[model samples]
Target: MSVMRVAGLSGLILSRALAMTVDFTQTESIKKGAGEAAWNMVRYYTGNNTGDTPGNLPDPYYWWEAGAMFGALIDYWVFTGDDSYNTITFQAMQHQVGDNDDYMPQNQTRSLGNDDQGFWLMAAMTAAENNFTNPASNQAQWLALAQAGFNEYVSRWDDADDTCGGGLRWQIYTFNNGYNYKNSIANGCFFNIAARLARYTGNTTYSDWAEKIFSWERGVNFINTDWQVLDGAGNAGTENCTQINGALFTYNAGIFLYGAAHMYNLTSSDTWKQRVTGLATSITTTFFKDGIMWEPPCEATACDTDQQAFKGHLARWMALTAKLADFTYDEFMPLLKSSGVAAAEQCSGSPTSDWKGHSGTACGFSWLKNSTWDGNYGVGEQMNAMSVIMTQLLSEAAAPYTSTTGGSSVGNANAGSNTNSDNLDPAPITTGDRIGAGILTTTIIASLLASVVLMIKE
Candidate 1:
């Protein structure tokens, strides 16, 4: 009995070790996992240039969701140095853009919303920044497309309105429901693209536009004193009607965060630094439960498709801020790491989950570590999980493989050396995590007990 007990205990320990051991050192593997997930999504949603079939995306296929998925693929290519997906990226770009590949027509592209157009432009900007070589054209062509997109936004800026003084409308279409809605997402996306373009091309025009947009947002009180970005105000028939809507969203925070990070990196001004830190603090305090992030309105119930997709931008930009801004990295790493690990654990047994670095299905939508899936698995869910995994993998790639004492290190490698001393582990483990560990132990023990009984009978 004593020997059986020891054997069972050993089995349990092995199971725990297997469960906990994720290879942070395997950069290629990590990139491949993320990249493949994006690839799988593209295959399902996007098809060959042979024209639109029942299986393929229809002609002029440019929407916010499709743009985001394409952006994820481009990010995967840039981060991993894998060009295998570049052909697919450009193929979609060809389908969406005008004949010159620079002008994205509102009619042809069906880009009714400024925010929707911004998403595609941002992906183009990323490709230009990374110098993604196109077989059909050059990097200059990609830059031209980005500039055209920017020019489109500049043309659409509604300075004539007295409500916010100056800001873009949610939709360029007059008949759209959100036409009267001056949303943060529109301005935030505009701000981010402007900042990124400024950094990429060293164009003061882009920076100036970014500054103007930021001021407009501040003026409207959409971005409050606490750095919490409210949703937006609409029906502003007059300046007196400038009451800002207070509903918060994660993507709004994310867009501003990344935009501010870029501007800070560009100028290194104290003001930008303060803005970056203030927004970071607000995001952590407001959106996170303990250390994991949740969309507040959607926590109790399943998030709508768009809301379900919102958190991915937050995850991506927060991680980007950590990578680009040294001052905020320490502050942001704890939540990023904890949430990332929890997300990974929660995703262990997801439908079509390809966790073993092999071909499988994409990850599920809910990222609350243990939240139940809302039964809507689509491109958005795939993009969200891909973004998080890519961010975590990049964090791992930045850390040293081994410690000075040669001791096996745990936690996020980029999370600084004196983690304990820094008191970064403020996150309380979720009950789900504890229950998950307990289940693993019980399963291993039961299997070992059955084996021991068989031996005794023999």
Candidate 2:
């Protein structure tokens, strides 16, 4: 009996030792390096550098890619509390929203897909939550734009479609490309934004929408019984039943996981918890091989521009899940930390450049790719690397981000009311606790080519 007791005590001691030894290396150099990489990508976008263009969409001013960059900037701000990019973030938001709080669908030649708009909306929602500074005229108005976007989805909900039993279509109009597809990303965005709105406003309507979206996804088998989230169904013709594409993209699981986390946070319901657990488990078991999360198709060579950007979203939400959901924190922390380290190490330790002086390390798309960038250094790659690093820093720092006092008044209080069917006001964009720009812009024109882009097919 004493020997057995000693063995049990030894096991307990070992467990405690391992718990205390969680490997978290959040160095200033590492964080600063990530910030520089992000800025490098931003400079590339503005046409100030000649390293590599974003993707098939040569127009640097594309809204969705810009949204991804903004997301990376937000993560950096949250992790380091550095306001270096505050002006850029503010300016980007200013240009993004139209006079009526609607996102102007202007991306050069490419038609604005629902997922593209949804990405910007998701970024706006993040800006609101993190107390990021906005234009004084639009203070606290991020939620209003978010609501307007959400309302747009609510209105566009095609209940008449027998194919998927009512979900948002990928394209706004039939004239635009991808109109026939009902994708995971489009519905996932709806679920995510609705869940976030529910948390922020404490409104049941948003929760109801969240629940309904999840149900539809489940009913259509897009989210399988095992919780594997497949790609969308192509609505090419009304004659064919909705066919599940079955390609497991990382971002699909990402938004769904985040939405589930938010729902659990807002409602404290066991169902949401179960959903969160199931989804996390599915992502862990189904998505990852050899303990590294990867989008399946691009495991070998370079992923397409869109798929190249997908893993960043997965990393972003996985970190969020670790932060927001207690059930998954313990499980995700080590994975995230290790993944971050692997990603950073894979980046070229020194910057590369041509004779014209454009210089930066291209982070390889695959985390498993332990070499320097063999492909173009576009917006997606930069965002993906920055995202992984910043998430790691934030997780290690364990900062508490509280909402500021003056910015709570959403431009449209009726956003949650579901009654303001009319035009949305030019909501508040107030300033808050943010860093002043007095420091320096020495890094702005440093001339490095970092990477950034998406998949066309549903």
Candidate 3:
């Protein structure tokens, strides 16, 4: 009996020791840990597996999450220089761009919220920004695909009809729940995507839309006096989107921070720079406890799968923000580095027979306990854990490319303009379009090269 008791204690000790296995400073360690975490996260994706469809996740996992997954996978590839998952990521992304080249794939329409579509759109945007391999020259180019989706959202901006003045409603379809709520997240994503598009395209229209969205959010008090972003206001005609939900979410904070950072980068405006600083300060104060990020509303209470994955988005945007607005790199890194290392420690989930016989390093959810796995595992948990760890690899990464930079994705400024009642994409990208894009790229490169040559001659 004593020996059995001793064995049980030893097992518990081993389970608790699962964390602290990852060293954030070492490139190889971070890559190995990120690879393992990514593998575990992808296991939840049966949608594109042997028995499943090409770009979807099976049961209980929503379509929006698949986009989020691809976004993280893109980051994973960029961080570690790994191409193992690129094929699957590419396949899944293309399969979901819908007929209009927007992310409104037919399969997800019934339950698709604006935020859902936005997640997929942002993934395409990420692909364009990072210059992730473009699809077949015959298929949609990344930037054009993103522009197509951005155009669709611009059309959907609810200023004229909605009671919230200018905010996006939570659900796109009226039949869906929360259709009346002009959620902060919906607008936050729209703003986030717009800012990125603005920076990538050098188009003032995108930046102007981003400003309009930011102004609307502030006007409605969704961004309160403290710059702490609140959840959506319930908008049932008379309710007027005024009765605020008064809840905070980490993803919202991250969304706002990243977008503001882009605005700062684009215009070098003090106003945007200040907003970025405020948002980062609020993010750290509200979400971080002892240097690790956490969800205040749902972490202590139970979080649904959707809530579980929120931190990954926060970490993702924060990393991107740090890169885009180099000024905030110092302010953002301390916590990012701490949370990342803490998260890495929890990657050693080797569950024994006493632990339900799980055999891999399944990532845990909570990073509060020192070197202790929280004993929970899922796609959300895995992604959240890996995201923070992968962020540590940022030190080794180059800033993302813009159209004027080395970015190779071809774009259409007007991809998503809906001329038909069916909302079809304006037209398929033609050979002429590709040639025009090539000429544009060549011109930009030539101009840059000429400037360099002139400088050398001088």
Candidate 4:
């Protein structure tokens, strides 16, 4: 309806005619709505073709958030069949796979945590599972990149040495502040990737790792019997991870749930299915209110840049879980449907729009407020909205590919640094990190020898 046609229309008729933001019943509507929301999200991205960075956003956004953004973009291409953002997504993933082939990029060394690196692992895994075009044969293959990150994480697994039985530390670098904590998102990411890799490669080792993580979380009480996914706990020797943080975040729940769903997919065992049932139910109980998805913990005004992005992850993995576990489709779809419309309704905000009659397209954080347009905007908000809306197309979308089901990305079992041994562990290492102890010892010995020779000459 154009401005001219707006004239003389009855209020009720006009209201009924206009879809709030999207109509899930129509595939075209879902695609159009998701595409518009994604385009608006891209407007915030400055790393596409300019001199900034191929996959990075501007200052306010962090590197890992960029990983999450590209992950969403991968899903966008999958759901809507749009290739517009593929180049940048590919460039970003490739550029950030630091020298060791793990996602521990040098530029983000100080800030890179296991969780931060895990987000990018998800993007690569998403590409492989969805069959997003593989990179040039010379570049890191998607499956291998995911495997590399997984390998590095496995190397860093806090086994006999660290706290809370076994889990990835929140931060990889010992100098970082959170090194003393073991968080669910970091370990959950490892578990999620492990499950998917197991399915994608027919590798039983990854499945074993996945099962171990699930057991550790439950055994350590990071995941309670009710399946409530808490945030983190203190490091091993210090707190023994005896005190769980108990804070709830959608991403944490989604991450664990996603991995569990894949576990059920891979093993048709009753044990995995029961675990999936518990986690999926927990997703709805903890994150959703009567079928509408919202971040109960942070959405009520305290969502930092990172927290604002959590709901989108929940929405995305929920749809994915539904696809992988057919039994979950019925329970998950209602949440997806309700949240998609709610999210889309808040997307009707832009600077140019007049409050009176015009509306523009920029997503907001408060989807529960719906149509009221929460007046907040950023990459997180946009990704959240887009993730919810695009997934509404799952009814028409194909199921994700498994190893025997058309997956084409090559794999390298030893992709990341396998350096962490009996007493050595490293990650998000600085640019100069070569072969660790050998290079450092060699340099030290050479200096000592040169000093002795100089003293003899003197």
Candidate 5:
């Protein structure tokens, strides 16, 4: 059958499949996809034989990819009650901690460009603490490694003179590249990792550092008067290929969302909630079109570039958006599935096709032949996107329901109150809930609008 015909059939099948059952057994593919994606990422990062050419080894060995994958694995295990995903994640952490040779000897003590390593370390630590029951589970070892890596990252910060305000410098280089400009995405990741570490270890120092960096980024470089993030404060007018001037990025936005969500979880502060909601709303309004999100230009001229090329970033932001929006499994599931499937389709015949690529590995896929960008295949973008998607999916699947006091409930406080027909709030969604409900809602609304137009025509 034609691709369009297949897509149509898949859409129909997805629409009808989850209407009746609320159980997780009904949506095992999402869980499995997340697990598989995480495993693929770990394999890719470890340079395992996936029958694909390896992309350029990421500086610091792409620990963020590993961290995010493990994070997703934890989320998957929580939702599906599957121990295997958790087991693999634990093993990956052990590999990182026990095998000191994972990093090159020259790169080991150098923390200058180690932003991703810290982020991934924290992710592994969180997973180990949450899942591992035995002392040999190495939860403590992973946490220590993450904490040490964080300390090394902290040392790279120039406290005396806040050049990029108070945020950490972009990287540590032996010979000065003279570029001290802090990147939004990197700082955002640092803030997120620091904040989570603070909460995990009961240490206020890490949290304070996270807040300081977040404040620095918000106050100095990115945040506009309306609190929207600009790409950066550096090189305002001149066009730089590496620096995308004044444009907001979906990945950067996702990092901020992750930070904000963690902040909200830690403090229960309304400020964090408002910021997250505003950013999320801005993202939905500005970049999202036809259920796909697009990346903002790295430069003014690139603004008109084909939006389809940025699907990886969109997928990442979508997962973050779902988390912040508190979307139920039923609501966001189809979108997740569609996004994953679409992205996977893009890399289907390429060398990186073995894994989801977008979320499971560190590289970029070759753009289609007719596209503007180079078709050079890599897995970094795909792996980054997949990690977030998987993490969100698993988290939703594993969330526990709490009984609502003085309410007719199935012991799941998040389960929508069936009686409040006038209340237009979508069902309460936790991180572990499936995205099916949100997708269903979107479908139903679209169908109704179509029917209304048909009636008017008749």
Candidate 6:
């Protein structure tokens, strides 16, 4: 079936949950499976898997990868409040920083790349600020590392253009071509990380950088008329429509929207607020259909090389749109829950198969034929999906606008209660705290097992 059909089927399957609890347990098992799949991919990177796996490499000390997983772990901790998640995530951040005074060299830092590192830095800063008082020294260290990384990134990439215009290039080539392309994704990261740092540090410089970059992006690259992102220079006038390579990148738009919203929170800038509203409207009206956003129209889709890659992008975009639109859990939850249910129903019994590059067991389900990149799912996609879902839940529970009003007296009383509850110190996770974690753990394991069995049967 087409992803659209699958998405439609999902709505039917999950209609009942629209008015019910938005707790993790109430979500579909497949959605949870997808979340576990993301975490498992990180587990592989962290050398936390069971077995003395022969191919296992030492956990990455690189900043970008570490930062991505750190962000994912923070999302996990926030959603499940599992202390182990916090502990493991903390260790991973420290690992990236290395031993005292033997810190990883600047040359090795990945923030210079202008992609994953910026996003990861934002995530790390968020975690550090949240947990600042609990583990003062560790929090300080993470924050310091992130700040240093940001400073280095700015020095290397910030050009002479306005803050928005002169952000980092998509990738830094050591080769002498100086062919750095200004990309939407990288600039989006700059906006997000800089704004986040500003909030945490009360530094106007970071906020200044964020505001400039965001304005530049909207005014320059983003096609306000159609909401399409333009490829730079040579590809000028052309909308980016390729996956991973900046055409219709959902994550790029997602990060930009999120950053714009957060910046509005920091400065209450009408311009930033309008940017968020405009982008959100553009995304909803342009990309979404039958509650699923189609993946970018890539050469792969045209060549029929692999449809799964497209599917991956579609899922990511839907998750992102749901969050940025600030769709109440009631309105947005069905998109994922339904998709999982449809997958489960369609592949009830089939031969279990594996996609070539994707880790973990695969199911025999095939949504698109003649797709070359079919079996090669990665940790990145899963992590993106998990983060989207968790963020959506948190966004809903917190009622994002509550903060905007400067007080709890607003339209959402439940959210006000939640805001108060969140302000209370999170109790240390112990035997008593295990109940919630146990539920999440059980749900994840059970979902994975079910998916494997379903794939095998199919």
* Total backbone clashes of candidate 5, pairs 3 or more residues apart or in separate chains: 40
Task: Give the Cα error of residue 150 in candidate 6, in Å.
Answer: 2.8
State each model's CA lDDT, in order.
0.61, 0.64, 0.75, 0.76, 0.43, 0.43
Clashing pairs in model 3, backbone N/Cα/C closer than 3 A: 19-345, 20-345, 47-56
Provide the TM-score for each candidate, comma-separated: 0.74, 0.78, 0.86, 0.85, 0.59, 0.60
- Sort the predicted structures by TM-score, highest score first: 3, 4, 2, 1, 6, 5
lDDT of 4 by residue, 209-297 (tens): 89999898888888887788877766544467775666778898899888888888888999999989998887787787766787766
Q: Which of candidates 4 and 6 reaches a greater TM-score? A: 4
* lDDT of each residue in 1-458, candidate 3, tens digit only: 22322333344456654443676667898888888788878877766656678778765678888899998899888888988889899999998888878788787888888889888888898899899988888788888877886777766666633366666767665556555567778898899889998998898878988998998998888887778888766654455766666667788778888889889988999899888888887887888998888887767755666777899889978887888888777877888889888787765566433222234465667777646665566678778887888888887777778889899899888787745212432223244633443443344333323322110001
| Model 6 accuracy (lDDT, Cα) | 0.43
Off by over 4 Å in 1: 1-29, 53-62, 99-103, 106-111, 135-140, 238-241, 348-362, 369-374, 395-458
Task: Show how many residue pairs clash in every candidate, following the order shown.
Answer: 1, 22, 3, 1, 40, 16
Estimate, for each residue in 1-458, the C-alpha lDDT of model 6 and write its tens digit: 23323333333323322211223455444345445544544544634455532112233223454565566566555454444556656654554443321123243433345664564555555555445213343332545555554554455453433223354555443221212345676676667767666655556767877777766665655434455543332111131211112245445555666666566666666776667666666555444445544344332233121222223333433343344344323444565554333322222111122212222222112322211113222344335344434443443222222222322111111111223221322222234333333343344333323322110000
lDDT of 2 at 277: 96
**Candidate 2 ranges beyond 4 A from true positions:** 1-24, 47-61, 105-110, 138-140, 236-241, 349-360, 371-376, 395-409, 413-458
Q: Name the runs in model 5 displaced over 4 angstroms.
A: 1-26, 32-92, 95-112, 132-140, 159-162, 174-179, 233-244, 298-341, 344-347, 350-378, 381-396, 399-458
Which candidate wins on lDDT? 4
Please, what's the RMSD in Å of model 6? 15.7
Report the poorest 10 consecutive residues by lDDT, candidate 6. Answer: 408-417
1-458 in candidate 5: lDDT tens per residue? 12322332333322222211112233565455444444444454542335522321343334344455555545545544667655555555554443442111233334334445544554544443443432353233544455555554555554323243245544444222223335665566567667656545545767777777777776664754455555543311131212323556555665666566556656767777677666665655554445533443422122212222234444544454454446323444455554444333332222323332332122223222111112223334345334434534545542221112111111111111223212222222232221232333334333323322110001
lDDT of 4 at 380: 82
Worst lDDT 10-window in candidate 3: 449-458
Candidates ranked, most accurate by lDDT first: 4, 3, 2, 1, 5, 6
